[model samples]
Target: MKKLFLLGILSLFLCVLVGNVALGEEEKISIAYIGASTDLPFWITLRNEARNQANELGVEFIDLTPPSMDAQAQKNSFDNAIQMGVSGIIVGAADSRAFDDSLDKASEVGIPVVAVDTGIDHPHIASLVQTDNLSSAKIAGQYILDHMTRPGKVLIIGGVLGHQTGDARKNGVTEVLEAAGVEVIFRAADWLPEKAYEVAQNELAANPDLTAVFAAWDPGAMSAKSVVAERGLTGKIIIVGFDGDPANLKAIKEGEILATIKQDNVKMGRDSISLLVDIINGKEVPKYIPIDGFIIDQSNVDEFLQ
Candidate 1:
């Protein structure tokens, strides 16, 4: 009987020892990603890739997403991360400037910040990883020129007039179209979907003979697609978009959108984690990281299908 008791105690001690080992493995280096909401495909992919990269590096990833596009809520998330004293922070702020004071606080605490997609200028920012919006927009414009019907009337549904990303994309396409003597009408929708939808329908009503349409983002492309469908003119209008979002890919496969600029979001995500990890390890990181964008059309749409 004493032998049996001794054996059971030995098993219990072995189980406790194994449990401690597992607990030790659970708490490694921790990384936090505070960015846009992940309900949409683009943001979801970005956060997912970052999480995957974190896992690859054997670190914990904290994904903090605002309920929606509320700037206040996004700032609150930043505050929460700062309060938690995360090893590092990644910012995709709705309003980059809104975090001015909070960023200073983060800096005071020595938490390095990396901006992705949407840029926020500050001395404490370790790096900015984003798409080459201007050049990619130029590609879309040149595509319009390449496939444009002679004497074409093109509609450009642009982002907010003064915003950097929007302006870069708008300018890229406009520079190409205007220089080629293409008649273009520009509508600034301030990056709102409903606004884009309104602008699209109004322009189509006024100019039923549009040769092509260029949108700054994928949703805008979808908006244009829907508007064109409403008038039973899907294939009639050559549509191009930015942000190689999933729905837009399906649309391109179906022959609705002609093409879109596909940002290397996977690189952005992986690189974001890499940069922060480097910073945590006292390693140097590049100031500006630019990921190229490519055209997604029916010819290669199958290659990108999820």
Candidate 2:
């Protein structure tokens, strides 16, 4: 009887040990998010949503954002995530073409990547989830064409011309304005609001009859607004921006900004993670996922204010 009791206790101990070993062997997914400056509300929304989605999916979430908008810094973050052996990576590239070598390394290690907001041109990139800036900018351009004064001189401020997101937005607006015989001028701020302000200031000073201004991002729009306000041309000029940042949305509501394009950031944030997870799990995903954008003006801005 004593021997049987000892045997039963040993069996129970062995079962518990095996259960712990099984639990220990189970793997948890880890996805790393590489993003640009969170200084902007757009990045903030995207990162938060990605983090939330990671939590819900029971995956380890790693957010690696550069301290500044420097391209090299973002590349370093990407490299770090790769070295950490993360299951996958999501990048919001500051420069679309900037990550080739790092992407090559990721491919060597068989880790897939998903790009958000800005698309990276690399085979290792499994998917790109972002707004359809080309189509959306057309909406803003059409709105500008319908509202601006005849014989209007419009200035289109944007980032570097080669950047996929900025180029698409700039081209969409420029094509429409040019087709309508509107005098369209472009200046690159290199994604800096201060530079955008300088451009707006110089242009406004040089061309007193400028009718409308189209900015590729909300900060650029706000910068133009500052210059316009400083020059007492607030009510005289029409201004529109992209990104639909919360602060900019408030500006639209308050009638400070005439009109702006609102990208579906919420969808972007959620879908980026969803796509990355799919790619990590050996599931196929569309190479290019385009989210839509719409115009928000005072007429419908109140709908978004809440």
- Over 4 Å off in model 1, which ranges? 1-28
Q: Which ten residues in a row have the lowest lDDT in candidate 1?
A: 23-32
Top candidate when judged by lDDT against the true structure:
2
TM for candidate 2 is 0.92
lDDT of 2 by residue, 173-238 (tens): 988888988889999998889999999999999988799999999999999999999988876799
lDDT of 1 at 231: 90
Best TM-score goes to which candidate?
A: 2
For all predictions, the C-alpha RMSD in Å is 5.9, 2.8
| 1-306: candidate 1 lDDT, tens digit per residue | 999999999999999999998776555556668776666567778888999999998888988877455567878888898999888888776566668788899999998889888777788888999998888888999998998655668999987666567778989998999998888899998666688889999999999778899998888889999999999988888999998999999999999999999988888889999998898778988999988888989999999998
